[model samples]
Target: MVSIAIIGRPNVGKSTLFNRLVGKRLALVDDQPGVTRDRRPGEGRLMDLSFEIVDTAGLENAHSESLSGRMREQTEEAIRIADLSLFMVDVKSGITPEDQDFAEVARRAGGKIVLVANKAEARDSDIGYLDAYALGLGDPVAISAEHGEGMGDLRDALVEALGIEVFDRDAVASDEAIVDVPVPEDDDTPLPYDETKPLRMAIVGRPNAGKSTLVNRMLGEERMLTGPEAGITRDSISVEWEWRGRHFKIFDTAGLRRKARVQEKLEKLSVADALRALKFAEVVVIVLDVTIPFERQDLTIVDLIAREGRAPVIAFNKWDIAEDRQELAKELREKTERLLPQVRGIRTVMISGETGEGLDRLMKAVVDTHRTWNSRVTTAKLNQWLERTIAHHPPPAVSGRRVTIKFMTQVKTRPPTFMLSTTRPEAIGASYSRYIINGLRDSFDLKGVPIRLGLRKPRNPYAAKKKRSS
Candidate 1:
């Protein structure tokens, strides 16, 4: 695929243009200068053309060891690797000294450059558009990345610069490649498992918890840069691989510290990126150091996974170093239950990231948890179980009248959510709800996944008649 890099001075709408092409908010965008410190790469689409697009930090002159200098290095590396560079300048701001300097640098980089005069929608930008010719990068493609104006001209320019055939204008405008599948006639029948859709899983934990190491072990290669230093990973990077003929997409996320300690701007962005991965994932593996496993931060991460409704599997890393394995396992189980009662019976596995021991068992646990997370129960079976459960231990009374559960149905699954209709639904307290949830978990074998039970008041048949009379 053709790789393109968006290179420009600070706040010229380069990141905005990158987001526009990628069709998603993959990079952080803000009004402030230098919001993007790292070079982020994503798949981009322009009309019918598909390619890889990289968003780089704004170019600036700084000391080699300074933060801005590191950003400059990252930008230069991106430019060096890209087949084409989109040298952007804020036409509204006109041609500045910084723009002139970077223009020369981009010219020396020796790649096909297409000058983009962003924010050209304004009438005042006419002079700046003419001034862009002084950079000697050919005719500038006037555009407004924010408002999405002049995209057709930009597409034409890219096609010309890349030396590709003219794209069919009528082709569908989709950011990703799509494959057609036959639709099922029956709505009740679940779709078959799609091996093409990669199972997305995220490995997350506190700093120095061997997240990167575990990723390397799983891939059977040192794909991730690992070290003894803490916070080595600054962004959530995803790697695609296959395990046992099943395609998988795993994300290795930045180690999260407590909110009070995370004061740095870049660290905050990294944490936000990790959370995006967590929400995107189908299953989350919380990797913990066996020696210091049950930290408050670990519990906090587990709570986050549960609240996000993603299936979770706890992996005690570095288990090979422990002395009393059996005793430690018993203590771990007890602590997990006591600490995370919200998600009881979550699957846990002990593994060594260094030696690759117990990885098979860990994968088994992950696959099982994912299956249970997606498991659904039919309404007939659900109502039957609900009836039997309520008969065994009926809902207690609040004040003078007793609460009555009329009917129940399974709404959906993927960490199953259910709806219950009852008389005076608000009368059911949290303890009773817990009892019903526990009953559902035990009866349907829906263990090791989060379950959501919502209550609804019974419909009033006479309310409509009363409204009609009024």
Candidate 2:
């Protein structure tokens, strides 16, 4: 695949230009001088051309010990590996010496160049177009990357500079025939996707977080319809799909409600569906909107996932137009940790069904997390993990008798169900059960998913001795 790099000086709208080109905000953007430091690579399709685009760290002349200086080194390395380059300049700011220096670096690299003048919406690059000639990078293409002004010229320039082929303009258009995503095959099915296996996933969140959008995205095509018209999806619909060569029969559940106000029949059914889905799913994807990343409904979903003994993976959707994404992601992570401390390490993925952005990351995380859910500890290894866990913080005493959990064995794969044989299962409090499940979820990296441990009271240990004495 063709590799394109957008290299320019800091605050030159390089990231804004890159986001416009690749149709993804993979590179973090800010009004500050230097917000992005990582070389964020993203995959995209431009008309018929499929390419890997690298949004590199902006070029800078800061001191060697400074972060910006290290970023400059990374940007230069990315340019050296690129097949083509898009040199961006802020039309409003004019050309800084940094721009000239980076232009020379790109020039020395000898890669195909398409110089772009961003923020041309005001005067249409009046001064910037004239200043472009001094950079010695040929005619600069003028466009507003933020407002999407002059995209036609930008597209033409990309085609000319990168030799991008022109396909049938209607290639991906769905006005005629609908496009369907491939289904997961049976052999590729993990423990959660098999026909007999209940694929437990919880559709949860506060009111109107697009839990429905997630269900529809997974179902796709005909025979199923879902949307955001408050409680439209009344009942849990069990739909099946083949994801990446594995078979998954999933339940498109209803929007969950809080425990107090769940007096309505519909709300009760919806909550029940969500609870059932969590029990059935080998892996669950919690739906959360980027606008409201984590709310009370989100916390309730996590609690339900923990209660039902299922695996969960958070879907932070609607990232297409998220503002303050860096802060949003940070807040989202912290909120999930604080709210659902039981599953502190549950995986969270930022995605957008509207733009199909970050779907691959979501799928990969789902698959990887599923593996952890299906993970089994050998009788020896489990006892080892169990022994160490108990020794570190032993079970508390209840009614003057210290509860002794003798052994634990994983009896099931889906949801990783385990059996913990103890002296008195009835005496085991809810808080202590969580202690073990939480320990398993964390120690085993079974984050964001449910792990169930059934507590069965050990047969009366002294019964045989007392009977013999009688």
Candidate 3:
């Protein structure tokens, strides 16, 4: 792949430009300088030109063993491997001595460099843009990474530095190349069990519970920012990946906290984004620290997933450090059974995010749960089962009248929603509802999936006619 790296002194808008090019906030960005201390790589696209981009730590001069010096080594390494580098500078701050130092480093690295003067949205930045010429790199492309200004000039600079033919933006938009190909007609046939369709899964849990670490392990790379600090992730980022030839799209969501404890405005937004990810996901893996297995918030998160009609897999993470494996497993199983009985028989997998242990089993459980979530029960089989189930332990009487469930039909799948037509639907007790739902789970082998059971009294035609006459 064509390789490019972003290298600059501390707080020069390098991370912001990196995010702008990579199309997401994959790197952590804060007003605090030196937020990024590692080299992060991602696939990036500029219009139609695709390349691998690396976001490096802010460059600075320090003792080799020091943190800032270590960060500088990472940036130098990125420059060494890259075919081109975007040497970014903060125009508002002008060319500091550090900027000149990194510029000299970039020049000696022997890679094509594009000088990017960021924060040029303000008129006052003109002097800094001129100061960039003293570095003797090249004419600086002045732009604002935050406001997305002067991208055309930046694109032109990148094209020239990469030594590529000028890209025809209009040609990229036109469909002329595929005009001769016949369009396939749409058929009303239902799709068969196809693995080509991307499996949509979301990883979620409480803050500092190794949610991001587990995601990075599954991806086989550090795609998300992870540190000892809580709430490092603020946005829900979906990454596409393939395993064993099966395509999958996994969402790495921000850690969820109790609503009452969530006081920060940014934390509230992050929680909202995480919830949105859960709703869009077909299967959710609730990451729990084995030592602190089931906090009240973890159960709440699982309940939310169940109520949203999505399948759930309880992943006990950090298993490598847990004290007693057998005891912890028993406790976790018992807690899952007692607490999340609504999503009865949810699959639980033990994993270690650091050691990469039990990942295959976790993935297998995920795939299996997704299959169960999309399962369908035949109408005849459902009704037959319902008859036998009701016969064994009939619905209890309410005010001297027993509720009679006449029929049941599956309304949908993907969480397996069903509608039961019944006499005295309003009289159905919560206990009886749980009994029927448990029966459905047991009979259909629909483990690890949330089942939605709805009661409906058959629409009364006479009532509608009576109302019209009145």
In terms of lDDT, the poorest run of 10 residues in model 3 is: 174-183
Ranking 1 against 3 by TM-score, winner: 3
Off by over 4 Å in 3: 1-84, 104-111, 163-192, 221-238, 264-273, 461-470
Q: Regarding lDDT, does 1 or 2 come out ahead?
A: 1
lDDT of 2 by residue, 1-470 (tens): 67788888778787776666567443446666565554555554455555667776678878855556656776777787888888988888788887888889889988889898888876645886678779999888888878878778876787887665532233232111112222232222223443333333445565566665665566564222333445544445455567676666656566676688789554664566556555656567777877765567677677777676566788888888998889888988887777777666888889876666777798778777767766655566678999999999888898889988899876766556778999888888888888888888767666766666789876877999999999
Q: By the lDDT metric, which is better: model 2 or model 3?
A: 3
Model 3 residue pairs with clashes:
none
The sequence of per-residue lDDT tens digits that candidate 1 reaches over residues 1-470 is 68899999989998899889889877767777887765667778877777778888899988967667767877888888899999999999899989999999998989889999999998799999999999999999999999999989998898898777433334334423122232222222444545455688999999999998899899897556566778867667677789888888888889999999999887898899899888888899999999998899999999999998899999999988998899999999998888888888888999999999999999889888888877666667777888899888999878878888888776666778778999887888899899988888888777778999989997899999999999
Alpha-carbon RMSD, each predicted model: 5.8, 19.0, 5.9
- For each candidate, what TM-score against the reference? 0.73, 0.50, 0.80
Assess the local accuracy of residue 311 in candidate 2 as a C-alpha lDDT between 0 and 100: 68
Task: Give the CA lDDT, 0 to 100, for residue 323 in model 3.
Answer: 84
Candidate 2 residue 442 Cα shift, in angstroms, is 3.7
Stretches off by above 4 angstroms in model 1 are 5-17, 29-39, 55-162, 165-196, 220-222, 466-470
What is the lDDT for 10 in model 3?
82
The best candidate in terms of TM-score: 3
* Candidate order, lDDT descending: 1, 3, 2
